[model samples]
Target: MRLHPDIPPGPLHEKWDNCRFSNTLVNPANRRKYEIIVVGTGLAGASAAASLAELGYNVKSFCIQDSPRRAHSIAAQGGINAAKNYQNDSDSVFRLFYDTIKGGDFRSREANVYRLAQISNAIIDHCAAQGVPFAREYGGTLANRSFGGAQVSRTFYARGQTGQQLLLGAYSSLMRQVAAGKVTIYSRREMMDVVVVDGQARGIIVRNLLTGELERYSANAVVLATGGYGNAFYLSTNAMASNVTAAWRAHKRGAGFANPCFVQIHPTCIPVHGDYQSKLTLMSESLRNDGRVWVPKKTNDL
Candidate 1:
């Protein structure tokens, strides 16, 4: 059977609004019956698990790190993009969408990109409400900065640790759900396989890194936020433990990989320092705002 995305039949601007209104809502009383297993605890996974638990679902969140906050997302140094137009730079949802599409060379789906742009402002507001401590101007308003591929000063940041602050916000929410007994967190557990029952993902098998023990977890649905397969290259900006194992196992269980070749390379990564170096360090993309890019004409030139 072929799959069709439930894209609403309307103008590009109205599709998301129309779809949200037309979608079916689950009764709050019945939400407790569903158990969702969210693999990985980065920004996407933690936020998802927290949000689902807040909506009354029983959520099991897993991460390979000793603490959920240590997920690779915390290593990101750049700020997040939002269409707040705080600088009155003519930035809008459409402009953000167009810029993203152009940056991706128009390979991204219009619906997905448009939806991301639409929610960009809400993301910033949500983060700020979580006390993310974003950089602000002397007037006490949130500060904005220009980032690569955008002319507007629309990137909201928290000094140079934007990802850390953002992850802390989500991590705080996740821990709140844990305290309320709405979410269960499995740290230092790496997903080994996706268990498919009757052609549907029903559970997962994970390995306890500390004890080398294998465990089975059954859930109504499994969400893989296990990040990318950049580690497949053997040398990348990904964490040391970042691997394709989870995604690879899912693919073996009949999940199709999309755009596997669309891996991104940060041009600002630190040059390899030695032959033994295992991972590349990334300089924040925001540095381009003032830093210049150049190369030495001779090997001995500093």
Candidate 2:
């Protein structure tokens, strides 16, 4: 098997810059002729579809829910971490990168983590400009909250509905693209199989959840932004619609899977007091900021 991780040659601080300068660009004149399929209209998928469509590409955006707003990303709380140094707390890209690596127990790729930190500031700025209504101080500066992993207060939040607000921003952009005729959204469709031609992923076959009809769509590229597989377990905190199917089908068609064990989870949740509960509800870890956590001193205390 052959794989290209696409790491650019440079110092860690310069690698993201190197990639931006070295990557090939798709001409705007020819973009309209290329069809790109983005599945799952969560924050990642919706943002990607909107951006690609804004670049003049013909995009087909698919989602399992009846509306993009219903995607599971809406369930997320807490806040987004960025090294903006807005709080004068000595925050920087390098610091965020190191913290992320350490938080992952040094198992994450340095390049990828560094890249994520580098772009975080831009994400926050874009989100704010999109009217996400993040909490701000009395002086009107964006408020910063401290989260579990980091030492500084760099998390930008929108009260307890950060994910919902962020998703709304992305969804608005996606709908703008749809109105411009650059993006076509297909709701209530579940991606069943990735269609590969000549050893290349060229399209997908999705099932209409309501009518049970199979529809085939061919595109120049396919993006699978399906969320986690927590549902794979009998009981989970994950959204019921979140499944491993789309990703697994793509994996069978030749996509690479890395760090399959790494997934997002919130430990501070409403506890399961009994076996009768089918699923437990997640309480935002951000609550740690203003509340004191109390637990039994020993197992016998319960």
Candidate 3:
């Protein structure tokens, strides 16, 4: 990979600030001409669509769910990770950046990871402003917890239903845009194919999941946020309807599918009783608090 001379080199902490001032901005007056089609109603897609609409873009959002709130994002048990360091646990953005890079086995781009850390704090503030009802302290600030491979207590949560609360926050903001008629919400519509009129994505072919009717939604740019391909494992934690079709089709057309073989299995899944089990219940990882696992060295010990 060749580095561009124009790009700034700095400690990860300063990279975003350097890039922000250096990046060119699209004029607000010209933003109205861009029509963006965002697929999926997860936090990323819904928030992007709503924010784009807020920025004066002609936005069209799609979700197979009858309501945006039903997207698989609502099923997240754990909380979203940020580098708030509210617990005085000696957390910092660089530690998070280092941990994430090490956790991903050094495969993730440093710049991208740094950018996520940069935006981590803002995401908390953004969610808070939307009245997300995050769990708070007696002083009425916010709560924090530890999660996964992190050494600090920077995870912001709303009970065990953090994803549900965050998704509701984004959904509420999306609905506000929909009510203003700035964004056109296409519910119960599953994108079947991306309509690439030229070398770039111009639109998409979507199926009305209810009536089986196919419709074409043309836009200046199409964004797909349909989520992971965990379904490839045959039996995983992903939603039953979730598939890689849209992203795979896009890959066939162009975009390279990165890290095609990453899997993370927690130890708390219920013991599979039989082959007929459709899904596994994810007991919160927090259960590691009380439960303990042990195995006898000798088979006869059982």
Can you list the residue pairs that collide in candidate 1? none
Per-candidate clashes come to: 0, 0, 0
Model 3 ranges off by over 4 Å: 1-11, 289-302
Q: Residue 160 deviation, candidate 1, in Å?
A: 1.5
lDDT score for residue 127 of model 3: 96
Q: Write the per-residue lDDT of candidate 3 for residues 1-302, one digit (tens) a residue.
A: 23343435787678778888888998999998889999988988899999999999989999988988998888787777788888988888888888989988998778888788878999999999988888899999898877775768888888889889999999999999999888998999987788887578999899999999999989999989887777778577778866778788887777667667876565677667688987667766655633445557699885
Off by over 4 Å in 1: 1-6, 295-302
Model 2 clashing residue pairs (backbone): none
Per-prediction TM-score, please?
0.95, 0.95, 0.90
- Is 2 or 3 the stronger prediction by lDDT? 2
True-structure lDDT of candidate 1: 0.90
Which clashing pairs does model 3 show?
Answer: none
lDDT by residue (tens digit), candidate 2, 165-266: 999999999999999999999999999999999888889999999999999999999888998888777767888777688988999888897767887777
